[model samples]
Target: MRTFFNIAAFAAGSQALITRGDSCCFHLTASGGASGSVGQLSDGQNRIGDNSLSPAEFCINSGAITDGNGRGCILTPPTTQLQCDEGATPTGGFSIDSSGKLEFQGSSKFIACETGQNGGLNIYTTESSALSNCKPIELMADSCAAPKPQPTSTSTSTAVATSASTASATATAPATPPANNGCPTTLTSGNFEFPHLIVPIDSSSPDTAAGTQFNGKVTSTVSSIFNFDIPQSDSGKTCSLVFLFPKQADLQTSSFTFSGDGKIDFAALSGIATKSTTFHNAPSVSKDLGTIAVSPGNQYVVSTFSCPAGQTVSYEMKNAGSTSLEFFEDFNPSP
Candidate 1:
């Protein structure tokens, strides 16, 4: 039924060694001294390494085949089905069907490639386990593109004008100072509008008016607090006029105060009720400033403070309840 043999020595040059069994045969050959050798296993119509003549059931070759047909080693799975296993239980690592299609089995199944213009490629299954366990994939851009141009002055003038007009209407205060003994006799209000309202990008080119106008508005309902930056040129000057307007009636009962660099200047109410308050520059601890009240026609309260160069000052109107409030600032060279 079967026969086996072992040869320890063989002649050099070209030689053909063939062995036969009941259902399988093997062919091995060597040529040109000891340069290279090739071996093939086959069953009548099929060979192991070279599948050109028919189809190799199984074949193994180290170097390229020099046969007249120029064939190499090849392995073909069975026509029916094929399964891989570790030991007893079926692992199903990979399989080939009769049509020569390969399929993979398991939870995390994917194919990865390492060569591409951007990076690499990754393909994953759409199963629930893959979706829940895998991390998100990120996509990248191929190349950079130019940026969009900014708007010109001619196109944005209307919008800038409308915003500046609204801010001037709601934030502008009366020219006259409040009639209180505590208030300074002479004060100056700077012509500069709110800086926050102006757009800095327009200052350079194309749309220049944006830098010249104040077009910002800030409204608060819970607390009447506002902060603004004072330019370096006005550092030694004083903020002579800080005005507050109450949009709702409930704001009348609250008190307003201005503080800079962590020091409180003075506090005032909306009516004629006077209170002794401390001033940041006053030599005495407190002064009897008359109650801070809204002007009859102006409908706003005013306070004053010494401005620090290149620093932000804050004004707070507490106890506003649900009433909305508006605030404005004016810096004067003299006080």
Candidate 2:
């Protein structure tokens, strides 16, 4: 029934004072204010539900309650005092009642969720969702659960689509061999400028040369040349050679063994070659550096290259195409 607000009551006007054995529960809501307060009540056994109590049993606070107007009419003794002081903030707290429902603070911040309290939380909506954004104040809880990882099986594959030119020599056709226009034809040994021309190993055989030959097939934009020739300089000076992959891709190879038959018959493969040049006339006096080689007719090998923007260069490599082989060498001049 109607519970009059008692200054000495448990939930203020929300519940009646326990007279030895008597007990009651109540729920509260702040319908009009920007923010509200709440409280909980319980005989520690039963719980209370919102508005379940008959209107007559409830009392309104004078300072906090109003008839929607300025000072219209403040209810009786208990109700008048139950009205919250003007601008008083609300902190909703709930407690269990004799039944099992929670009794909560009559003011607004719906923070409590026990019996006899306002269970008006829309868990998934803005108001309730706002709870997460609130600064977290710690209250020793049992434990925090570990976070779950995102599944990758269903994630999009990020394999980059690299170009073929990034691998083997793009073509066997010579691009007007590096300009020898200003190159001295008969300069003294050891005196030279760069953009140095590669000496082609001249031979009628397609695969036999003085040095080792690469045998794998290069699956790239470039093609292999039948003429294995790099014009030699004056000769007799030890030198080194380097090959670059103009772009980033892969060059697969089976092995690095070179056959003396003058061919490199590599297995399955992918190859990348950008700048591949042999150096001549260095100080290899009485020295012999074996040739670099790859194997497996079709095995792709890892390669790297970064070409400047605007200008393009072929980055490719060649392997024993089905059964192809290339030859190389380290030789001294004919004394």
Candidate 3:
């Protein structure tokens, strides 16, 4: 089966793609345009995989489809390959279709997928993989249902937020505590500037475990579960979760690659607990916030929720690309 770009039909933030029989999902080459023909992301797709990061943006606009980084997709002139450009002007606009014909721009030429010698799939705009002798591989990447998560018998949980700010030593204590309620209004994450820096934690490893050492680094890139000793403004007022990532300069000095495109990942609040380890390996309910990207230009990113009064809440982020989230006293008003 074949698919085409249907620009007019695409809704804002419409989701797309996951090739069947493959567990490997797509990632935007950290430096777009430099890695490939242009920066290639989920051309129009983001497949959620096992221990994967949250889905990157695969937004659709009337003019073109942008990558997770919000860079506009463009065609490389003289060559049919399409990619996201970095400050590079687009050669032309892209038209999409779902007629399953694999055609581009309604011409004799068709969209094609060619497997390179390096075993990479390259998208091109020349001839139909089927209609032409040029014969490219037809990668009919259809929509596949996301598989359900199985139980983690020896469950592990922790989260450190990613932000580009210097964290303060004092934590923001919870507001309007009901006499003995001990909800702190501020939370922060550990330092794992790069994925390699992430240290895994489990019950057996108290030094690394957030449950055992509640004051240890409160975040981990290695696991999806994050238990936060929150900054609960329990006055029935909203509470904020702050995330800090190393700045570009720090990342350069440390010789670490930027892990995420600065988009705040979605986290559903799972079980609340007196101790995070006690909540581990226990089944519980969860809350869902719809899809949206975090704007990190504010030095730090903040996510506010209905404060869970006196309890420490665990946000179950389902991706590894998600930075260790922290909590801040307040959101910066200036960019």
Candidate 4:
């Protein structure tokens, strides 16, 4: 029942892409070389502009369906034209039902956008989302495949009153700086939160030191590591490095993490759910710096952002569900 996905008008006056308004579009099956839908530049080589119009916004990924820029439409190897690829893990990730019915990891295949092989309009899912020339693209045209919201700091929303648990206490104090209290740039919710000790990143990447903090988890993956500091009076004010999942469905990627040692389920299955972190490094594994997307009407999220205050903020963090990530720094506020 959600359908206005114009996706920022497919942008074409200057360039650069991503303008954003919670947009969505992905309709493609045209033949004149383009035009049924597609717009966040899906890497198949870019060509979407018969006047563009709209369409190209899908983001449900725990394995892949990505296209609001996270890419992944991949299911290739059969005809070879389907490849939007950014972090492609596809084989699963598309499911949609409450009676809306969309399937891909639910497996009868079905994504089909059509035209392929270089003739243009490419994208497919095979076994039929009704291919022939391809054109089955419907999820109400598009409005909910999410994934994009990780910056928090306009006073952190300023109204959380309660609900917390990393030893709970929910401390609050820092938020007076958009020129010393005129505030409202957005981040305020930091009734203060604490609980430390995290060391698991034995170098699959991020920086090269994991000799202590007691030396645990890094058995080969599920990365972790910690270090925090940022008080010069919070210098210019935007501080967020949060994580606390006791259940907003434990923020998802679910196999029941936190206790269920199933390897990497730190809540790992909602659109492939997130747990990627990397700050202060310099190379190409990418999370850019930190990635946080855990929502069940909000489960105290926000996993990265710092300001000019002082310094020392290292987090190597990895992915999967529940391995312990309760942090608060000039942070808090999300009941």
Candidate 5:
């Protein structure tokens, strides 16, 4: 059937015609920039508006129609070709490539899917396979749900037996040895120092032999032993000293001994001595502090010693290794 109508007779912005069709197509044309060729189509109980102004443009506005069944329009692609904006070459916005990939052109173009409930949008492939085979790029907020844990059955007697076995095993285990009560684990460059030959004794009288005496000098009349210089107030308190060598020094195959006539003994010292490279411009000879030999290694040699109250002690290096020895004292004694 063919019908013709002059849209100028209708009021401006008015609904000019209404048609009911199951399978029909309408071609609209307008001239002189006229804007009154608006009409409505009835597809069953749904009313679809046809607001066409030019040959290349048409729009459907359903604001005047209401349906509780949530009806919508579907545009099926004929021969797998779909285009927007009169099939014009899109400078930006949405497009589908020949590979069937939906692409958004331009930097600011985006597609936003809004959901009103906790559910999120899901995308799947057209392949006929299990859902697990299709991996989705999840970008939704809090969309993943954790699987619930299943319960297992256990008997009271079995649980009690297992608890008893664990307790018995724990009780039969051997006790662990105590941790090493030693000097600080980390040593810095500042911890090294040139060995001091003599330090003033902590005494009331400078000439007192009791606390201000030194052993016989190794080369000179004046003893050249490395003095610890324990304060008179700190007498009788235990202390520790750590001897360290530079990285260039080898610690293996080196030996050191501490010997002096200050009533001190090697029973308080503990460390390994190792061979090391000779230091440049090192002193030709080093004095002795004690009589006992100490093994040398890369590790620091720790010595725990104490001087009797109102008495003084002197310490000297008897065996200077390949490298010059540097000594540091732990003024803060370990408990």
Candidate 6:
């Protein structure tokens, strides 16, 4: 059976607080606080507020346990809260303030959190269904003291798609200036997948190199597998470079990188061919670039994004450049 929580309204402008506890879930709402102030509680460990409200000022050893997650104090109309156990899987908790601003809370020690429902609790940003902007926050526990020895399987699926082929195509086209191509301000799904690669950087000259470097060491590997899952769709993908570095000579400390929102030229990752190469300024190390390779688009799932082990999935890069390049790979899905 589902459990319903009780909440009490204190002063018309008083605040509320939520803390850490072990419960399946809780739903709460509260009102009152500074003019634009908002407050909420979830579980028994957390006490939070937003621009609309501030943290409770007065004192309390265990705070209110009224409307929200088991034992949280409230100070706003938009207050909501939730809490649960870390049994094998993780779960999420939630809160809504008096201004209708919904918030999410997750436990770091027991379970990790997600952005939407399915694991447990739900929250709405508005009263009307059409205007409701409710999202779920899923949390999972990877470790628990409870022992439930489950079977361990060896069959592995692709965490992400991984490919193993020597690409012969090269980046023969020259670098062009940025143009308006309807590229969305945000990179959601349906956009070109962010390309990953390793580039060789020269450190001797700091001003000119594409990235920074130190001592005998230079560039750093900026790689990740991500999920390109936006409902809206668009054209091809393009990438630029951005770099970060430290002051002294420490190979382990200082590093080089590609430019702003850069994409590691697959041709570079493949160590094959180049269309245009330039060096601007320097006071650091510089040298030949590195090799590039391609793995299964799904490999991005494993290497970049997160997914359950042994799950079958595929990924593709939308509007990719015509150039082909070499690629390395590995795909072991969890079971």
Q: Each model's TM-score, in the order given? A: 0.21, 0.16, 0.28, 0.26, 0.20, 0.18
If the candidates were sorted by their lDDT against the true structure, best first, what order would they fall in? 4, 3, 1, 5, 6, 2
lDDT of 2 at 224: 30
Model 2 backbone overlap count: 106
What is the C-alpha lDDT profile of model 3 across 19-129, one tens digit per residue?
111122233221111122212334432211112234343333321344656665555533446566555432212222232221222221424343432323445555443
Question: How do the residues 1-335 of candidate 2 rate in per-residue lDDT, one tens digit apiece?
Answer: 00000001011112211111111223333322111222222211111223333211222121111122222211112111122222232111112222322222111122222221453211110123323322111111111111112222231211111111112211111012221101010111121111111112222332333231232222221123211112232122111111222111222321222332121211111221122322221112121111113232221112111212222222212332232333221111101
lDDT (tens digit, per residue) of candidate 6 on 217-310:
1123221111112111111222111111122132222222222211122211112111121122211212111111112221110011111122
Residue 271 of model 3, lDDT score:
52
Candidate 4 residues 1-335, lDDT tens each?
Answer: 00000101111111111111122344432233234444434354322333343455565422235566666565455443445676664333343332333433232233334344443344454444344655434322243322222222432322222222221111122322212111111123323323233344434554554443322232334454443334455443433333333343333222222332212222211111112323233222323222232322222222112343454334443543334332222222333
Error of 6 at 161 (Å): 5.7
- Over 4 Å off in model 3, which ranges? 1-221, 224-226, 230-233, 248-265, 273-285, 289-302, 318-335
Candidate 4 off by > 4 Å: 1-34, 38-88, 91-118, 121-141, 145-189, 203-222, 225-316, 319-335
Candidate with the greatest lDDT versus the true structure: 4
Q: How much does each candidate deviate from the true structure in C-alpha RMSD?
A: 39.5, 37.6, 19.0, 17.6, 40.8, 22.8
lDDT of 1 by residue, 1-335 (tens): 00000111111111111110011212222122111112222322211123233322221111011121323222112111111112211111121211222222111122222112222222222223222222222111111111112222221101000111111111111112211111111112323343332221211232222222222222221222223454555433333322223233323332223222111122222211111111221122122111121221121112233434465433333221122222323331211
lDDT against the true structure, per candidate, is 0.22, 0.19, 0.30, 0.32, 0.20, 0.20
Candidate 6 yields a Cα-based lDDT of 0.20
Compared with the true structure, model 5 gives a TM-score of: 0.20
